[model samples]
Target: MTTLPDGLHDFLAEAGWAGGTIEPLPGDASFRRYFRLRDGERRAMLMHAPPPHEDPVPFLDVAAWLTANGMRAPAIHHAEPEAGWVLLEDFGDDRMRDWLDARPGDERAAYEAAVDALVQLHRLPPGPFAPYDMDAYLREVRLFTEWYAPAMGLTVDEAGHEAAWREALEPLLARQEPGVTVLRDYHAENIMLLDGRSGGPQGLIDFQDALVGHPAYDLVSLLQDARRDVSAALEAAMLDRYAAATGAQDDFRADYARLGAQRNAKIVGIFTRLAKRDRKPRYLAMIPRVWEAMERDLAHPALAPVARWFDANIPGDVRRAQGGKIA
Candidate 1:
């Protein structure tokens, strides 16, 4: 089991959260650590990060920016700069996954709420927020070819397949879309359903690392989830729904499908790496779900060529690893 610094208990004692128990929370990619501490309605979170590995500074800066721009983020109360620990406002206990999984009939309604929230988030003006440029995005996408292929003991056909992936992505990059802050992890897990709303306003955890990216990126994140399964018909309907909501051109569906291919490709490599490099095996199970979404998305008209490539080149095993029963 992973752990925080030795003085963590002493530190919590000093924060008036003494009676609260400490339970370590599961993390995805970052080096930061989280703990759920509570005694009652007075719930709060503790974050720990070490230098070079993680830093809460950007999170602080962005949280203020998001607050000013009308988003509900964890309110910071106390902090120790040298120690990398902060006490934050509790968003309470409703993970969107639990809420949606409990009622599949309510899925579309909740997703619609998420789409509306994405609209508001993307609409934010960008003078204060730093640019999430192509360099960072491209660097992120390359993770599949770099970390993924190596972990799988696969060559990745770097000279060939890598090019295909980029060529497939060029149109998406050319789209030149501007959006407000894009919570790169805008999926069910991070979103919280507050009160009676079907997919209540975002509770917003893990957004300190948000990238200033295309609004559609986040929409892809929510609808074409890597972990949970979203039906193809639902994905299509939601794609159209988002377009109608924003009055965007129907071309949005094509762009959405293409982007789905790009994102899922990166994720395939990522899950392999997570297991091989980080020794975190849980991510391996998510491999196929992401692939399934990619396959369904590639069925779109604009992605016909991409579909052809996967059909011909990306092995049957690749698809199987991506989560299809192959019946």
Candidate 2:
């Protein structure tokens, strides 16, 4: 049996879950850890988001907002934000990614549902979160220059990187209205396939970093997933579906491609940081996949400036990810 974290038992006891058996669940790239708590027929998910590194308040706030808006964010049963423990309604083990892996034929349906969930979410007004603005965008892309490039033993032109991204992301930043709530990480793994829920069957998790951003952002995050491969055909079809549903067909493709490039670039940097700074080398193996998606996005005309920057800075051979310990 896995040993529980200190004060976990007393904490659970305080929440009326004293004797529940706790079992750790697989974690994500972040510092948060999840566990299943069972006391006879009662069940809940315990999120251990230790302080100074992780915060449960944002998760609590976002969950309340989503559920209030008719979305399927997990219901929060109890929380002690200071210590970073939250007891949530368990949505079960059927993550969209794992589900599709087991039932390959259900890919289209699963993706459609995921896309529709975004559609439903996009229709709502912006949330009480920070805008995914230029500063934020540049900050994220800088991860590539700061971490990934150096780790790869390549010195990149940081000024050129920022200028190219600023130009490329200009269109996205010009939206007149406050954008929809972007569940920053809305990919397959963060989505749970809850049975029998209508209109919004997908259960959202890992959404503490939700932002008010362009509608295209979450779609890009979903289609150009870093952890999984979403095929080109499916990506195109879903893009079309979102555009059709939202009446955003005009320039929507450009925006999607642009965000895809930006997001993938950020992931490449984040993965490198995870490996080098945090000593989690496993994320290094995922860099190639992120690079492939970023390359695809760069092919679009919308990403010309950023693509040119890549052409000038990172060469073909160096663009590829290699397996090794970062010194």
Candidate 3:
């Protein structure tokens, strides 16, 4: 059995979960670790986020906001913010990705439900979160030059790259609609398929990094998933659904395309950093898909400036030069 972290045993015991069996759960690309605590028929998820690395307050606040707004976020049964531990409601093992894999026929329904959940979330008043503004956006994409470029044995002119990105992204940012609460990682893995739920079928997790951003941001994250394949047809259908539901059809496609490009660019850099710096090479395998998605997003006329910058800098050859195979 996996040894529980110090203080966790006593914490659970104090919370009436004494003598429960603890089993480690799969983690994401963050400092947080999850474990399943079971005591007879009762079960809860324990989140261990080491201090100085992560804080549980944002997650707790967001969960309460989501729940208050009639959305499905895990309930915080208990919390120890200073110690970075939280006991959350168990949403079960039905992560959307794994569930969809087992039932391919339900893909469309699952995606539609996910979109429905987003529609409900967008209806809620915006929360107090940092804006995903241009500065933040630029800072995130800089990870490309900072990490990926070096890994590819290429030299990056930081000033020149930033200038190009700024010129390319300025107009796009100006054209976006007002911001909303954007769950930064709204992909399939972080979404749970909970049936018979009042709020929605999707149970949200991993949303501590939520930000106020263009409504299209989470849509881009969902449709242009970095680690999974979402069919073009399904993506289009969901986009239509979201646009119609939220009355954001005006310039919606342009916004989607622009945000998709921005998001994929950021992911490439993040994945590269994860592989090289964090020593998690598994993320490297997802780069080609991200690059492919970025290329597709760049095909939109609205992304011309960004596309031109990418063509001049990263280019196809360097992007596809992985595993000795050209993508």
Candidate 4:
């Protein structure tokens, strides 16, 4: 029996869920919290995203758009966005990461379905969302210098870093097509595997920060997951599958690589910030995995400029170290 706020209790009661059991679920990196509610045979998920630090409007809007578009975002049963509480359809506990951990043999099939979902999603025009443009890209990549570099006790060439990222990213941005809806966090953990759904269409979650961006962005997020290992062979095969399906073989690889490097750099900074500023040190352990994925992406020719910047700024020892810890 977890203690909840008076506002949440009133919201649930107004939604006809009074006297239900409230079970708090594990939280994620954001300021949001979730709980499971039960009344008789009924079950619903409660998303408590308090304002000032978090907002539920974007999540509610995106969920509606996805469900309306015939995708698998959790159906919103009830919502009071001003109060930062949303009651949602329960897409039970089978996250893609946990599911794969139990059935390693199902990896390929599961990933194929995931890729197909992305194909379906990319076909839809982007919703009302901000563009993941040059300023956005630069702001995200600078997290490395702003947080991770200082935390690692290393002073880096901030000017060179920006120049390198510009050289690598501008070309990709220049030739961008009509952008697709990019679920900025489309990795395994954020994806759910619903039980008894035929073909196991994934249940999408944690996409409040959706944006209009290159098609390659979400693909990189899925295949180069930070919390888990996606083998090189599987990544290549998936890229091939996406290319074959979409006829985007021309410059997809470069786009994927550049975005991958940028995304991973941002993750490195975020994880460091979480540890340093937010007092959540567990994220520190994931930095090494993120570094490996970033390195793989930086190997692509399109990422040469950024790679050179990293080589000149971040020492090889720090790059290889777990969590980028100096000590």
Candidate 5:
């Protein structure tokens, strides 16, 4: 067993969970780590985010907003922001991925619930999260050149890449409708299915990176997942549902395609960096799926220039030539 940090023990004791047993939970791509705490029949989640690296402020703020808006976010039982320890409500182990794996036939209902949660969230008044504007979008995609390019033993014309991306993406940016709270990572893995929750059936996690952005952004993130395969049929259905529910379906498909490409491009770089720099190669296996999704997004007529750039530089054969291995 991994030894518990002294501070964690102290924090738990201060929070009156002193004798609770700690069991490490599966971690995500971030610096934060989660553990389940059990004291007799009571349970809670402990989030350990080392300071100077990861902060709990955003998670705390977003959780508050989500709960306030009638969505199901984990309640904060105790918080020690300065020490980077937070005790959160245990939403149980019903992550959407695991739930779907166990009941393949229920995929549609699960996705519908997830989409409904988004619809409710979008209805809420916008919060103070940072804008996911063009500058931020461009900044994120640079990871493609910064990490993925270097790992594939290829050189990138950084200036040329950014300029081209700007040209391709600016029009889409200009066409964006008013923004909503975009939970930067709204895919299945971060969503919890609360079987009997009073507010909503879906619970959101991993939203510290939330931003106020184009309403289509989270929808893109949901249907065009990086780590998992979301079928085209389900994706289409969810898009239709969101559009019909929100009445902002005007040019929604175009926005979805544009943002999907941008996001997958960023993921390609991030996953590569995780393997080569962070020494976590498991993320590499998901690259091909992300690349495939990016290709689909680039096929949109609006992305012709971006598509041309990829064709000129990382030809299809060469891009997939890595054969699922980053090293």
Candidate 6:
């Protein structure tokens, strides 16, 4: 197994370095690690990604684009090409989640700020830097059936459920008129609560996976969060907010509900695969809430067949698998 890189501390120190206070930070996902440094009043972050997994090129490109688009993603100060190591701008881990959660009722205001940030992000021109095209979106949508379906231990159900799901995905996919460069995972976790942000949005991080997708996908990510539940009223309010701004109120409910079903179904398979194959059990607990969201979204007329498939064949067997009796 390849170990993580030694980071800037050892890299610079071994060369008789004289500046930067370095300290290793905590809470890295299973695949990566990070550290922070204070160098002559300038704060920076060091990310270490070991071999067989680590690649920094995408992060560099996406961060540059988001920064250029008026978002405060940290700048890449230095890097070691072959080592899979990089020194990046330090946007402290003051995530929107933590800041909003502490303030209680302030969740609405914080979420509004988040929505505004997203609006600005989604309305920007898609440059060569932000290449979110149909091929990529289709491939990503296929992951629901490609990886997640098998992970769920369903032996390819009759009526070709996967095929039906794929069929359902087409109309909505065709309706997308790409507005802005989409950051695929625009949620509270990836966004930082900047100290003094003056641009079009808040600080952004971990946006290497940015893609051009249906704008609704990110909106679904924010309102239909897997980690925490935002209430129904607020969720509706957000939908109205985005619709009014875009003037696309033509069945926004159906649109969001369809998108929500698509997202939640994809996540179900993903969370299961994570627990079973990747050994990431934490995601499994979040699956139930996502399932509930799917159930609600599928209530609309557009998702009748998709909802029927779930109702007849599967109503969350994972919960039963976890020793909780199915109702």
| Best candidate (score: TM-score) | 4
Error of 3 at 324 (Å): 7.4
Q: Write the per-residue lDDT of candidate 3 for residues 64-89, one digit (tens) a residue.
A: 88888888899888888888889999
Tens digits of per-residue lDDT, candidate 2, 1-327, equal: 676778798789889998778899878778888899898999899999999999999999999999999999998888899998999999998888888778788888888999999999988888899888989999999998999888878888999999999999998777625789998899988899899322238999999999888898889889988888889899989988988898996677788888899998998889889888888889887887888888888999889999999999987777653323345
Q: Which runs in model 4 stand beyond 4 Å of their true positions? A: 196-199, 322-327
What TM-score goes with each of the models? Answer: 0.86, 0.96, 0.94, 0.97, 0.95, 0.84
What is the per-residue lDDT of model 6 for residues 84-193, given as tens digits with 9 covering 90 to 100?
Answer: 67777777767777776676666777778888887777778764545445454445545555555555554445445655565555566655655456666667777787
| Candidate 6 positional error at 165, Å | 1.9
Backbone clashes for every candidate come to 2, 0, 0, 0, 0, 1
Predictions in order: lDDT: 0.72, 0.87, 0.82, 0.89, 0.84, 0.68
- lDDT per residue (tens digit) for residues 184-220 in model 1: 7788888887665666677777777676656677788
Candidate 1 C-alpha error for residue 61, in Å? 2.4
The residue ranges of model 5 lying beyond 4 angstroms of the native Cα positions read 174-177, 196-200, 322-325
Candidate 5, residues 1-327: lDDT per residue as tens digits? 687765988899899999888999877788889999999999999999878899999999999988888888899999999889999999998888888788778788888888888888888777788878889999998999888877777776788788878887787665544568889899888889887322239889999889888778888888888877899988988899988898965477877888898899999999988888888988888888898889889999877877877777775666666426456
Off by over 4 Å in 3: 172-178, 196-200, 322-327
Model 4, poorest ten-residue lDDT window?
A: 318-327
How many pairs of residues in model 4 come into backbone collision? 0
- Looking at model 2, the pairs that clash are none
TM-score of 5: 0.95
RMSD of 3: 2.4
Tens digit of per-residue lDDT, candidate 4, span 63-142: 98899898999999999989899999999888899888988888898888889999999889887888999999999999
* Model 1: colliding residue pairs: 288-322, 288-323
- Stretches of candidate 2 above 4 Å error? 196-200, 320-327
- TM-score, cand. 3: 0.94
